[model samples]
Target chain A: MQPQRIAVVGAGAVGSYFGMRLAEAGHDVRFLMRRDYDAVKSGGLHLSSHLGDLSLEAATVERTPEALAAHGPVDWVLVGLKATAIPDIPKLVGPLLSEGTRVLAIMNGLSVDEEIAAELPAGTSLFGGLGFIGVIRGEPGQILHQEFGAINLGHHGDDPHELQRGVDLFAGSKVEIRPEASLLKARWEKLCWNIPFNGLCVIAGGVPVDQVIEDPPLYDAAHELIKEIVAAGNADLEAHGQSARIDGPRIAHLFLTQTLGMGAYRPSTVIDYNNGRPLELDAIFRQPVQRASQLGIGVPMMSMVASLVGKLGERVE
Target chain B: MQPQRIAVVGAGAVGSYFGMRLAEAGHDVRFLMRRDYDAVKSGGLHLSSHLGDLSLEAATVERTPEALAAHGPVDWVLVGLKATAIPDIPKLVGPLLSEGTRVLAIMNGLSVDEEIAAELPAGTSLFGGLGFIGVIRGEPGQILHQEFGAINLGHHGDDPHELQRGVDLFAGSKVEIRPEASLLKARWEKLCWNIPFNGLCVIAGGVPVDQVIEDPPLYDAAHELIKEIVAAGNADLEAHGQSARIDGPRIAHLFLTQTLGMGAYRPSTVIDYNNGRPLELDAIFRQPVQRASQLGIGVPMMSMVASLVGKLGERVE
Candidate 1:
């Protein structure tokens, strides 16, 4: 596999963790950041993780897209921003993409690929990447990885070469990357866990994942929400002549057991909400629920949580 | 109408406010208090209302049910405690009842009449009263009436005289009392507002009713919840051979407009959850959703809110 030049936009926890992994894999990884640019530039980037503590002593950091673009078009532009930062994507990443540059989004929620696809130059190959990791930004230029470090990557069309390219990008890294056949199905499958856990965490006043799992009623609520997401996902798949990949009971059990082992880890949504920052409500909640509604599928639980989280996001703003 | 003796068994806001009104109406109103005993005994009960300001100087206050029972079989026992205080009802208010005594529960939630009925002496006449008033106990003995002073009273059995007797007690008071033929139906009707406004207020992290109404998504969420409550209410009513009284859109409109005028009133459930007091979860949320589930009616919104609020209550404790 050939090493690629990668530019990471919105280098927060997700961005820094993955970019650091790519840099460790011997790729020339550049990070375009806003808040933590100075810290990352001076101190480099550090990841204290269960796998191993690693640091990039002198990482390439840029404060703006103009500075990142000055280095010429990169092979892979990894968009790792929160969904709330979607509006800033066109301005931030448009100039950093070349004709052959493929963009991979390590973010949450459904239709994220399409949303970013619309913002980028036409014919730019897009890959959807779902990060199932429990990592947090502890301090400036530092990350604390609690548990899980796996990414599911899938391309726009049925091209195994394109999918393998995304997988091969993390070849010698600590993070696991698995190529998926259907990006849409993978996103909806991810939503099976994200919709309930993240939304419930915020709606329940920023309660941690373990607290939600330990409480029987909240657990039952989470189970019901997971089932609703699965139902909506399967319905959407069937409508598109695709077989269902999400099993409600199976995924719910997996999430509960996994989250129980996660201790008191707070989800990113809860952290953003607690800090009075804008929630990724549109990408994580509203888009999927609205799409389900448009398909004439009922998602009462998701609808309720979406409206609530949306209002909560507005309140914080 | 003959003047009768009335004993208020829970001297919180609901207890004190109505107890003060009955005392002003020249009825022999006695309060069986716990936390506010000394405050009421020394300071008396003061009510500042839009209609008029009133106070009771040297009012009858009892520290125990035995003390209240010593007054000899009160004509009416008003069980005005929070539903969390229900388990103590058999011990606290059981001694205060006599053969001819009628119990009127001015409380929130459904099946409350049945809960109190099981605890009280058999063959005692029972009535359910839903308070639409916006009154809060500011201090120990002082109550602030915000707006809307109306109570819907309904008897257990179909008897006009029993309903009229319940109405006649508040004849000289400043509240509007309407008698309904069915207590069960009335409880469900109040839940159309309670399940949404009260439940959403807590679920949205203690957002005030005015804020909930002002925000579009929250209001939409509240509207959807109201519709679910109405659907569940009508289904329950139809199964019981009763017609529906809750009009979803109409009640939603009324609540929104009325709440717009309510300024920043916090619902009682929000208050209870905020103060770390035990929420009236079983009566207000769990029972209704369970009943709806048992009847094969879907109440996804209520189930989610109830579970979230229930967990929230547990966390606070």
Candidate 2:
């Protein structure tokens, strides 16, 4: 297979980690950073991961998409920006995409691809990916990989070959990549964990996963939240002519067991909230809740959590 | 009517304000304080209210219920301790109660009467009072009445005369005293406001009432929470062979409008949680939530809020 030229837009934690992985896999990877442009450009990118530590001494870096695209039309523009950054995507990444360039969003939350799709030029191929990794940007040019790292990838359109191509990008990497036929299903499945853990952690005032799980009532509430999200997600899937992909009890048990082994992890949203950064409320919370509402599903827990985190985000902003 | 003897146990804010009111009404009101005993004993009790300012020069104060009881069996023991202090009530106020001495709990939350009932002697007529007042202890011996000052009093057993006697204590005072047939109904109604504002305020990191209301989403969540609490309350009332008295929309509108006029008020639970004091979780949050669960009423919003606030309270304690 020919090595693909990839532009990593918004190279923060998720972007830099995956971009480095792709770079290590011998792909021509370039990073587009905003605030940490100077630091990343000077020092390159570093990843301290459970799998293994990685350092890139001389990697392609850019301050903007225009700068990234100035060289040539890249094969793929891998977006790693927080979902809160969705509004700026069309204008920022419009200049970066050619007709055949596929934009893969390695971001968390539902309806993210749709939001990005609304802004992109018509016929711009989009692939949605949910990164189930506990990765954080410790500092400029530094990424801390806490625990589980996996990517569930699926093309927005029904193109098996296209999905396979996206999957092949991470063929030999240690990071697990699962290709799915339905991106929406994948998104909903991921929300089974995100909605409860991320939402509750922030709602509980930025406590760790262990603390939230250890408290009996809170743990019970977490399960209740997960159940509500699953119900809503299934309702949404049914609306979209798809079957339920998330099993509440099974998924909740899996999350609890897995999270227990992951140690005391502070979710991305919690970290974002505590650091006074913009939360990915629209993508991770509001969009999914709105979709669930449109489908006539009641997600009171999610709605409340969304309201709380959204308000907290506003206060900080 | 003869002036009755009253013991104001746990005279923090609600106790001091009402105790002073009864005293001003020419009743023999004695205060039993814990933390502010020295200051209050030295400076007496000061109440700054919308209706009028009150300064007591020679207030009868005691540090313990035994000391207060040493004078005699008081006609009324107005218990104003935080709901978290319920465990100490049986031990603290046990000696203060006699056959005819009625205990009026001016504290907040549900099943408070039951908790107190468990610890008190059999047939010790209990009157539960919900203080709808926005009074706070600004400092030792100082009570700042922010806005509305009303108390809804109801008897635990079938005794209208018992309830009226409790109401008659504040007959001529500025504090509006309302007599209800059912204390449980009143408790649940008060929770409609408490669960949303107090729970969310603390959950949102000690945000004020106005801030919670000003944010559109938070305001909506507050309304949703009130609706759930009303549903649960009605369910609880129905379980007790009573009909629903609390209208979700009407009561919610009343609370929102009244809160708007009250400016920014930091609720007692929020203050307690922020100041590292015990939250009235069992009575305020857990009891009602448990009642809802028992009746198979799905109060997802309340459950989540309860869990969040309950966890925060635990962390602080």
TM-scores of chain B, in order: 0.96, 0.96
- B1-317, model 2: which lDDT tens digit per residue? 58988888888888898889899998899988877788878998888887899998778888877888898878888899888788898878888887788888888878788888898889888888899988888788888988788898898873788887887778887778888888888888899889989989998887778877876667888888899999888888888988647777899999988877766789888788778888888888998889999999988778878888877887888
Residue-level lDDT of model 1, residues B9-45, one tens digit each, is: 8878887888888888888999988777889899898
Give Cα-based local distance difference scores for all models. Answer: 0.84, 0.84
Backbone clashes counted, model 1: 0
Best by TM-score: 2
Docking class of 1: acceptable
* Residue B51's lDDT in candidate 2: 89
Specify the poorest-scoring 10-residue window by lDDT in model 1 chain A. A240-249
Q: Could you give candidate 2's per-residue lDDT for residues A110-198 as a string of tens digits?
A: 98888889988889889988888888888888889888789989888747889998888888877698998888888988887887788
lDDT of 2 at A274: 85
True contacts kept of each: 0.51, 0.49
Model 1, residue A101: distance off in Å is 4.9
> Candidate 2 recovers what fraction of true contacts?
0.49
DockQ of each: 0.36, 0.37
